[model samples]
Target chain A: MRALDVDYMLGLLPILLGYVPLTLFMAVVGMAFALVLAALMAVERVVRIPVLDIFVRLFISFFRGTPLLVQLFLFYFGLPQMLSFLTTINGVTATIMGLTLHFSAYMAESIRAAILGVDRAQWEASLAVGMTQAQMMRRIILPQAARVAAPTLVNYFIDMVKSTSLAFTLGVTELMGAAQKEAAGSFLYFEAFLVVATIYWIMVEALSFGQRRLETFLNKAHAR
Target chain B: MISVQNLNKSFGATPVLQDISLDIQPGERVVVIGPSGTGKSTLLRCLNFLDTPDSGKITIGDLSVDAAHASRADILGLRRRTGFVFQNYALFANKTARQNITEALVTVKGMSRADADARADTILRETGLEARADAYPASLSGGQQQRVGIGRAMALDAELLLFDEPTSALDPEWVGEVLDLMRKLAESRQTMLIVTHEMQFAREIADRILFMDDGRIAEEGPPADLLDTPRDPRTRAFLRRVG
Candidate 1:
């Protein structure tokens, strides 16, 4: 077996740095879409309207039951064959769409659980004060639910950042993609992959740190 | 200003309130007393449409609150006019005492934040919770939480206030503080309907006392007459047991 090439690996660091922004961009954009979609799905489940609730349940089940990688292929490769209009969808767009749908499903369930975790008497108390259902949700319920759901949502965001690496499989040149290309060209696979893994590990660690702070802040009211 | 006609409520096959009908005049203070599981709480909850009756009509002032005929908006409107205080206090655990009082004011009434805060501060002081205004519900004692609950209701400025076993959860020493607040509320002629096990508080503050059994009014009259000389044997037995 050949020894690892330290200099060559150190030299690839600058090249990999160029793809960092794109990786960050994908994660940020995916999170924005996921958060909005998750909030809507969470509210829908809470309201439990007749037919719409069934549709939301199916939506959540489908996205959460399957691997995100399969969903990405289905969206980027499979869907276009069925609907020609989606043929022009770029790798970046497809990756974001896949990430959003997958994460939103998980987020919806977490948020819904948080919303349900609130005391039932709060609902009665809110109604007793004359608040409409919409008013009760917007003013009383959501604010409280958001506090409980925030830490979990942040955890999902960290998972989302890691998941963005799958965009490399979709032919998007995110950090992992750049690392793979660099490793293949130089035949220093282990070194390039190690750098990529470190970057992801750092991102997740930073997010987890932030998550701890957020949980403490939100739970401040309950902490005697 | 409140009237109930043929009110009937049942949970599945079990009947809770049967043919319960009564009228309460404006500025009246009525205390409902009964054994546990006798539907005293259900009757009070039904009055505010919190627990919808299977059949009956409840008229508060001129507003009708029957689930069949009343629209959601109409029910909400009626609820706003009737403030309810619960046995457990039910203050939103996440909010401070001041925010708990001001939330409905700002959200439902659309008052400015400054205006809501001012009114909430006034009511907090009125309930003797001004010093704990910024405290969260978890930080407050059970009695203080109930005081905040009362302030939350009073902040709405409703025509009728409903108390469902308000002091039942408090320590015996703390119960006095809550009952004292109720005494002040009664003195101010605030029309109130209270369901309580505190016979002494009921005797001291209630203008009218109602003894309920199996969901029907067994007897009702001025507290003095009802407490000292209940006409119905059921009422007599209940009073004796509670005393």
Candidate 2:
């Protein structure tokens, strides 16, 4: 309503950008943990090993069915009530823990489906060549599965980066947190939020560009 | 180099391979021909324990495994001794034609990467795919893919090569190239057990042609005896239908 505060937003830009490292750090660490945990969960689902299969299925369903915000609250506020050790974890730890578990649920299903999508003939071919089960996975199945899973994995990573914005609610001073403070101080909510949104937009656009190049390179051999 | 005695396999109550007994000497080429679902493919798959036979004794070179009680080592030995070519080319889509050839040489045989690479070069040239050595299966034609599949099997140099309907999945135009490659391999006497529907090709390369029917080898003999004058009425009926 008041004439757009260009000077105010310009002053706020560096402050918002200053928190970029924390935001990226959360995203990077969360992704690494989620990818590994998702892979393990996917393996259990594929092999369906006894009692663990049921637990993994339920875990995936619970995380996927719940909102990321609610899951974050549960990790930060709810879980610590029951488990004493969780009380020592700061807001950043809780946010990372929440992001890892929440995104990994979705990732695990996609990963499992990708693994299953590989042609059965590949398994036979590997075995016929005297590959141990582990070799068949390492040399043949997983590599193919990883290619199939790539685009989806990249999509989730981008989404996870955006979801890092939610960490502001948990009291972590990420980009969104810095903007929230800047908006509170300047009373220029529109301009403050606008810059943060644009920064996120630029960030995602860069990721999308990278994803396109990766997909093209991966598709080269399969392209007819 | 491989012998199977009383090898039986069943899919839950329905028997797929029933009382199959056979012997293949080194350098022999045995071709099995029969109608679909009659266990011709199953016989080849069971030989490598891919289908996991119900009851049998399999002896390959000096290593032997019992169907019902094979240990991990026994099954691995069985797989190591025999190479299988699938109805589908089944080349690793992620691997190039050359890597397809080298994968087993390095993984199963424990050759160094350099040695495996060298072996891959030889196989690629032998299969006439030297020009396409770096090509992946997805980019290759059905014929080229099968050539890589054969090359992959060849690189292993197993005592026995088992082909389970190798050309059955190929396009009509692609079948001839694969058959030609197989004929070439046969000439080199690689000791093969091939299950094929290509009767004419069977007659040409077969030292022994097995006529399988109702989950059993109903009749078998040299190609001339089986093709010209089949002893069993079922064999005659089958050949008449296919011919």
Tell me, by TM-score, which candidate is best: 1
In candidate 2, residue B53 scores what lDDT? Answer: 89
Candidate 2, residue A31: Cα displacement in angstroms equals 1.2
What's the i-RMS for candidate 2 in angstroms? 1.0
Model 1 interface Cα RMSD in Å: 1.1
Candidate 1 residue runs with Cα over 4 Å from true position:
none
RMSD of 1: 1.7
- Residue-level lDDT of model 2, residues B1-243, one tens digit each, is 688999999999999988999999999999998888999988888888888989999999999888899998998998998888888888888888888898889888999999999998988887888899998888899999999999888888899999989998889999998999999999999999999999999999999999999999999999999999999999999999998
Fnat of all models, as shown: 0.74, 0.82
Displacement of residue B153 (Cα, Å) in model 2 is: 0.5
- What's the chain B TM-score of candidate 1? 0.97
Off by over 4 Å in 2: A78-87
